[model samples]
Target: MVLPLELLQQFKASDFSDQQEYEAWRSRNLKVLEAGLLVHPLVPLDKSDNASQRLRQIIRGASEKPIETGKNSESMQVLRSAVMSLACRSPDRSASDFCHWADGFPLNLHLYQMLLETCFDASEDGSIIDEIDEVLELLKKTWVILGINQMLHNLCFTWVFFHRFVTTAQVDIDLLHAADNHMDEVAKDAKSTKDSVYSKILSSTLSSILGWAEKRLLAYHDTFNASNIEYMQSIVSLGVSAARILVEDISNEYRRRRREETDVARSRVDTYIRSSLRTAFAQVSSAELSD
Candidate 1:
């Protein structure tokens, strides 16, 4: 809280291109404070608490008009006092020097995702950094504070890997395969936990993956040719793995049944192959008619 305010004070109007940019930057920091302290705090907030009220009032006013970030400014002092008062309060009323404003559920996930982005090479499109091993080790240090476990890390990494493949023109077969490999770990994590929040996140993440994979697989004849046929196997595997986890692990009805009886991946792949072949045939016939 004070750190952000301090940084704001350290920045001058000259540091930015114009007053508008400075105001925008100041507003973003204020929004971060509001989100961490009031919106999704690690300890559930008490609306009637004096410190919470004061912080909320300050944030609301600052939203309409940016507050002065000067160390000696009256509003800055009030804001700092309110933030510290709220941040210092523990759920059990214990006194502590440490604060946990940024460790809440979705907020923590978002912050961790930002940190994970550093694993990629900024200079080389779609490539991971050579220092990935070191960067990953350092990132692990924040796991305690971010409430991240292996499962969450695997899920986020898979998404990021897959996203890079897409954003960089999808030429990276290794990225696709790496993402598919991560799904194996994700599947294990899915089966081992039944936490409602974790399940919600798992469903959302896997659904995105499955949706993207199926979009390509369901019409593989159109999406892949000899030049990129290597992608088909990995994409199919990722889609099937995601589908199996969603059905057998997450869905209650499917959990009651056995995988041996349904064989989700095999059946799903069979469907994709047949559908793609049919589509390819239909297109050929239509083209002949047009000619």
Candidate 2:
């Protein structure tokens, strides 16, 4: 397939200040993921060979490389930019899709059970929705362990015309802000002035982590075909399940407490940070470095 002139132009002008910047630029041009539709399914690609090669290259080293063009772009750089940016155009808006799927469609029975038992919204309002940003954030860090890297390697091979394209993972931070703000607006205090506001912020933070996981896990399914989509789905179920369990167990400590929701969320997030790192090591199937 021919590289679009617009793509070339954007590539030539791409910026890179650090790892974060490099990943950001790659997400915009290479991934083409915008908006909040990360969970939607994917169509097969026309340029399987090139796209796969680029995807792997980018994931392996987007932070290290600067913007270059043509053959000089480096596979990791191109892959990082393309897969994530393209696939995650409207990630946050797609958060609702998690509930849709979790309600029981493709996910196996074990996963479905795990999802609900773990990721409940608990809003007496019954208006709970998985914040995509939260899920994406969780899934992003976790996938660094298995599913994401595996997808990269798989895509590196010629498109089997089967495996899903798990090139992207994300949750919109902007939406997270909106959710936190909304929590603030709608909250009715039961105690001190800080209680409701803190609750809102606390829940919003929890929402951000799980929301990122929700979408990142779902977005993975887009990468595969009917045959392998199920495989990716299984991974999603496990990821969300783990997140749900961890979040709920921690939430139970002080979810509705008069003034400790924020504390609980922070404390839990700290634990999660460690767990996430452990998940990373689990995904390090390539090799384990000895200290």
Candidate 3:
């Protein structure tokens, strides 16, 4: 979900600052934007007519504006408008509708607003390392939580091979970004906390789940050799059922911890997964009939 380098360069060029200062500022903001995207992938523009084009226009408009004061500029307004329109037009209209509606374009806009505030503070005091560190840590936690939920969704809704491919690709991208963006600092801070034990346990559990899912996915792919639709159905049913139980267990754990944000996120993801799985199964059934 990295923004295009050319667009980043164009945006940086519009800032009224020296090369070193602008580069530093751009790098920080880019990390925040990347964090935002990691938590919320962009929706496929094909899901809706012209929405992706509109989003690109809004982004390009931001690049053309004065970067220092562009938070409230006309470009920002248009960008907000585009987000609202896309959200409203999305097929999923639940309270957590935006979660399933598109990528984190709207969420990234919020990150930009946070960046604007940090920029304003930096202009006044010239020191915001503490604030920056705090924001980055929060983003890292959000990214991990969202990544887990997204993997769950993919397991339930997507074809086995496609799901495995995309999830593996995303994990690679996330590791690459973390390596590049000083995420080691965030890891260090987490390691220092008492919650580190719980975090490690959760991490272990998630890794095991993914490993199990990979084996199932591979088996499902092999079922194609015999043209055995029943075998394929059984595999998918087992996978989806296991995913639902796992999701429920995690949701209950979040509830016990009183993590309202995680609860909400999980609920939204659960809704979408159930809906999507139903559609996927229906499609498979329809295809069998057509055969």
Candidate 4:
């Protein structure tokens, strides 16, 4: 995991051709970091502990270095090693600790932007999707475990951005299912702390996502409606069912609070749902007319 000093120098000297190059580089390096876990076979407990500590040290050192070089560079490999090592040890680590450690490195919104680019890159094979999913899953688990309700907005936005790459109807449906699961977890966590503004905001965002998912389901149904597609219909049914459950959950939460602010949040949710539905319907209608 400790990149060679020579490699670090090269990374400092390296320049990306474009955003795509940087994204590809970042994605490849992350994969390398994840793959590094498999490099060492099962060993003695003492030896394993030592190796793990050494890996962490290397990762930490590399992360502190200034390296924006292209993919597979030494610095990238070292940083990836650190990220994966942290992820593997997440059961013992908290999200705040992880974020604090990462804050020392150049991994803020820039890393996420690079990740988003990788997700939207169609030229690559579908493996990138799995990578994106893994990262999101890790973040979601960390946020949930730490009870970081405020981070839900960013998490939700990440999910929404990822929706753009779900080209197929089945994938869209699957994404909705995944979103439903995440939202359910978030809602459960929120319910534990009723009458809190953070919880209310989280609830409002969840409602918006459910409403958006429903519209996407309808849009997918319209786009693929050559004839009676049973799977698509099933997906739509599942989405509707999930949306109803989420909406009801948020409604009950708002009613229980009965605060003016909660009422405003509820109104915003209604507006979001209506706007999303209208946009989805318009897109479908336009497509149909063009056809």
Best by lDDT: 1
Ranking by lDDT: 1, 4, 3, 2
Expressed as tens digits, the lDDT of each residue in 49-150 for candidate 4 is 543565555544544653555455665565555444444343344332332123211232233433444443366422246566666565554444344434
Residue pairs with backbone overlap in model 1: none
Q: Estimate TM-scores for all models.
A: 0.69, 0.23, 0.25, 0.36
Per-residue accuracy of model 1 over 179-227 as CA lDDT, tens digit each: 9999999999988888999899989998998899889988888899889
Q: Rate the local accuracy (lDDT) of all candidates.
A: 0.84, 0.36, 0.41, 0.45
lDDT by residue for model 3 (1-291), tens: 133322443463457468767656655554443333333444433544464457655444545653332445554455444454444443443223343333543454345334334412344322224465676445445445344232322222122222232345322222223222332232333234444433443344434544554454543433244533434343343334334333434434644664444444345345545655666687789999999
Better of 2 and 3 by lDDT: 3
Q: Quote the positional error of residue 72 for candidate 3 in Å.
A: 6.3
Best by TM-score: 1
**What are the per-residue Cα lDDT tens digits for candidate 2 across 1-291?**
112224544454334447655444444443322111122223223344353445445534544764454435554345445554443333343312222211112122222222322222333222224673474355445443333332222221111111111211212223223333333222222122343433443354435444644454433423446654435434333334334433443355545555433443445345545665565566564356532
Query: Which runs in model 2 stand beyond 4 Å of their true positions?
Result: 1-11, 14-27, 31-41, 44-57, 70-180, 185-291
Model 4 off-target regions past 4 Å?
1-14, 17-19, 23-173, 195-197, 214-247, 252-291
**lDDT-superior candidate, 1 or 3:** 1
Off by over 4 Å in 3: 1-43, 67-73, 92-144, 147-291
Alpha-carbon RMSD of each model = 7.5, 20.5, 15.8, 14.6
